[model samples]
Target: MAASPSLANDNKSNVQRTKTSLSHLPYEVKQCIVYWVDRFQKEPHRFGSDSLLDQIAGGINHPGKTESRNNHPLLAPPSAQLTNLLNMHRFFHTTSTTNNDNKPSIRPQCNSILALCLVDRMFYDICRPLIWQTLDLEQFHLSKLRSLRTGGLTRNAEYVRKMSWRISVHELEALWPDLREELGANDEARKGQDWDESSRSTEILAILEMCTKVTSLDLDLRPTELDKQTGEFTIDETETTSKFFYPISRLTQLTSIALTTPLLANNSFTEQFLVRLIRDMSELQSFKCYGTDSVTPDLEGFSWPLPCGSPLGLHLSELTSLKELYLQQSDCFDFTWSKIEWAGNLEKLTFDGCTRNPLRTLHAFCQKFSTSLRYLKLDYLEYEKDVYTTLLEPTRDGPLSEIKSGQYRLDLPELTTLSITTELPIDLLLNFRDCKNIKSIELAMNPSISAEQIRELPCFWPKLEKLKITINTKSDLARCQITALKMTYWGKGIELEIEDEDEQYNSARFGHAYEDDGYDSYDSYHDDDSD
Candidate 1:
């Protein structure tokens, strides 16, 4: 206690001037700890890993799975609960690199927000809007439009709110070297093209007019040619429709588009620029489109005609604030769904590999969005196999038995996630046995679905809670994993998830099929499609 050396050097200079770092916290605690270290450095198994316990140990050989921590490999020292259960999963899932679609790509590793922006200037202004939100130019080049025009990244394009470009025609003739002499002086059978006054802006429309706050695009005009007999990039619809849809119809504050084209099924000038860019968006809420994987599950339905008095169903009923409509392998059954008076504010409808006659237009378009649908999916849907017992039997008659005795059973009442596939049966699950607020089911089941039709799905979804069930072989994925572990030990909290589609049908018979589930692989370009 020999204090007083000038009062202990002024209390060690007031404890080195109140030492605290992350720029002295509290800017909402340094933005919630830099938003969970930028989601633990971009989705570290959503903050806990070991590949989510090997995806809850259902990577097969079942008998209530969970045992292999790689057969006792952790020789000691790792504990901080084994380094937070290996959240950096062997340094971000085994050091990446697999691309040309064999999958495992993994690039975006922002080096923990560039080492928390070198720990200064308030973490480079909180990691500059998480590194300019998202501007994925899907392998785009022209030196990334000359580094978003003259190396400034167009003043951080208002922190781009999601984009995934891929427009083509050789990236618009390398951003208009007179765009192939203005498409051969505007006469390639001129239905539309008219950008004259010195080609009204080009470099991809000045980087999508400097991304004025994009709201989830994804564009991808799909013009890959290569295939000198199997070098790959096959589909090429002879490139024409790209005035980048006239600067993507001036964005109109897009709210989720998706597009990916193959000239919207035989291009009537890209189906009149996707019906005037979905009638100027009107704040579109999720549209998805997709189209060409060169469709096939016996390819017949592909109608688009329109233009007679074409209001395009009153411009898709003025969108009325649409909600999530996806139509992969596109041309969703030549619309006019009784002049589509909009899906009464639809909530997630999807119709993948759409071909035709789902009882002549999907049970009157799911009985006009059966009371605000909540996630319906219908995958690989090409009709006929006695069209779901001639549209749910009910003592068979014409015109779907007066909509199956009026209001045809699909009483959605705010459904809760159902995905289809086994080519619709189980008597069309009695048209969604009064959906009973279904909670996540995704079947794809085929081996003639029985174990008494999986014990009548908890007596028709009494609030079913998650069942996946993909199965296509390996002895019906071990007899549907012993009837989903006897419906989860009979207590029925459900939670089952099995997949094995015979290694996705031998990787879609070796053409290396990779549509990663959000639809399109109609059995990888169809060889008499079955599962």
Candidate 2:
């Protein structure tokens, strides 16, 4: 049945009226609506499989690999495959999701913004900048770079504010042919010249040059080509390996920088480069470095008690804006602390998996920054001597005696959060009695800490709001009983979380333990009325 002429005319008039109403909205209002709609469409969970909690708990060490879905011949059919690859990069990239059968499968990228752009030209202009604000080049292909070079997305480079590039040897190998082509090298020219790593460095530098407004940069230059049997890769020590540092040092506008590579650990040139880099960036606030091993900078020529006015010492002293310093698997504590009296404005400090140092050195370092330090995390740290006797014990003649007699306390007045993994958490807490404002504490406790010791926590910090206790135990029943007992004392106002060290083992054992008892779940034991 065909529609009547009057009905079709009325529908057309209604559609036009709605479009006119949308167009009449103010420019700022339209932009705000579009920005929020984009965020709603691409929520955090839709971005990747890993949760925010996993990142905070340090569960993920390295970036996850992107599963490949399509393959093409390397030499032949370059044009068609390049187009297909760009299309896949644009839309078909996968995010992890589960099917009804409880198996992992690929979920296509959300294209709501692309659909919204097609509604009108105003919507298209507003949504384009938001889409290009953050670029994660974890699954970068050579074709994507090619697109950027040919003015396909080159004009949008100014919109980028944050960028992360995780480059590996495999990515360099895949990029070689396209890079040579872009450089105007013919087949004969490619065969005549040797493959120089500097050419690969130049390609990365070129990409960075386009994004001048980037404020946060995450660069992981660690090689991914590990031996299958040994699970290790040889560190490359050539001039070309250090070329990437030149472009990075030029990014003085960056406020936050996270670098995960062994260059800082193995290369002497990296130490000098870092000093120069830190000297130039006056606005740099947060710096995090993760290395393959303990990052003890090679200070070979320097004499004992490095002079305060020395080049390295002067450069570090110039970091008046540095607030957060995190060194993972790095022994920068001894070298850095010994050189300077204190980091100028440092508030948050983390030393995760660092090598054992003298307890007195750590004690002196903390005391130096006690007034300004707000958050401290010492995970998996070890000491050369007993912590209680070396740090907590009070002798009549020693400075710690003031803490025992109530004349003074460990003066971390600004501290509100503390996380530590040690044998004696109780003794460590006693040392920080002056931190009256501390609201959150995370402790990795061993079996030596009895359930009775947990009850004493509230008395120490009456304003405590959150406590996360991770028990290192082989006995599941013991962990459960201890957790239940702690919850009883903690009550309902505070947020309390208890978990075992072996997550998988605890999950399997807790199922049977809960079934045997009357409780339906572990959380049920938290009820105040329960016996």
Candidate 3:
């Protein structure tokens, strides 16, 4: 897209007008150049994905003192001063021209558009909006966003299309007084437990209003509680939560929204607001509610109390425009697949650490949306019962009455990609018997999967292009069987990947040590578990 002059500045004289031969390139080409230049920048390893912060219970020092904990050096917020100065004079746009320093230590992690600004005025004018397209804002510096909006930074705000906020409950609380003062909140409201929701909502609204063009938002809202005597930080039952519904509802341009932490909502207003917020986002296409283990994972069986008299009530099926849905480690009550009839347009669905959903619910899901679904990922999700055992020794199928009932047949004609990991039922895999369109399949090895079952996978997925299986270290000699299977059938060019549980679990979840032979130690028992 061509850069908008109103996005940053319209004055050509303010930018360095160097007449270089490269300046003749098109604006889109310059954006391409900026992309390649920034391709090597180190991205955040874990952007609020892990639940380490959530595990910290009880009160600790305020977030201001520990602000560096959440600060991502690569995603530093935009400098209003630098942007304003660049807009005022050409000299400010001209940066160091040294291009030979390829060393990582000397590399600049700032937006690549800044480098283009140094090239010439034409390039600067063409590439300025590229810098503001995506922003990583921390709670500590959120107060400055309002200043940037009013004081010569409004143009830059409109350029923002995506935003990721790394918020700490402590830091948000610490900065509350300042934000309250900025919004003209009273002293009583600032000190009291029941803070003025209007001022708080207005503060967020003010900030979000400035970034009128934002479409995607990733929020890491981890709440913390303070210990009065011990001076420790922990998560307590404190009711201090911010209301974001009204503020977030104003993002009419939003298409993609992701909540990486469950503590984003603190009180009734925030919870109810979230439902309304989702309902109002008419343009939303991709929605993800990611959870760290601290919140949803802990409330496995507990039902999330729904707001009274609220029609929406956290059910997202009403979002007819939604195309992709991703839920990770979130409680089943937060949003149930069976509770609402999903839009027919839904294409990609992912469930991670969200294992509480019944097998029947999943079966029904595939039956309901099988025509439109294409990509499906079920990772770290466990089945309610051991379908493998039930299939082998069947008195009653419990809820999975397959052969006796003979009514429920697995049928998804549109699915192309499927991934399942960690304690998935063998009966669930039977559903793939009818999914002929599956091109890629990922399965995690457990005691439930027999050698015969593994051999039959390729038969079921005739169009399989890629196969990835994770073998648990405890499963004896399963790796050898997988290798044999690969050599037997996969020599025809199907991509095959077999990862040990140590490698998969260590990097992905809690660290667990192991041997290269897929055991805890060299002397561990080696009885064959594969049937």
TM-score winner among the candidates?
A: 2
| Model 2 alpha-carbon drift over 4 Å, by segment | 1-24, 31-129, 144-152, 169-202, 221-240, 262-270, 291-314, 335-343, 356-359, 384-409, 473-479, 482-486, 499-531
lDDT of each: 0.53, 0.53, 0.52
User: Candidate 2, residues 431-474: lDDT per residue as tens digits?
Assistant: 67668888888887764566676667777887777777787763
Q: Candidate 1 vs candidate 3: which has greater lDDT?
A: 1
* lDDT of each residue in 369-393, candidate 3, tens digit only: 8778777777775545565236544
Candidate 1, clashing residue pairs?
none
Off by over 4 Å in 1: 1-19, 24-35, 40-122, 125-130, 136-201, 205-217, 220-259, 262-289, 293-327, 330-351, 354-380, 385-423, 426-531
Query: Which candidate would rank higher by TM-score, 1 or 2?
Result: 2
Arranged by TM-score with the best first, the candidates are 2, 3, 1
lDDT of 3 at 412: 80
When summed lDDT is taken over every stretch of 10 residues in candidate 2, the lowest stretch is 509-518
Candidate 1 vs candidate 3: the TM-score winner is 3
Error of 3 at 246 (Å): 2.9
TM-scores of all predicted structures: 0.31, 0.58, 0.56
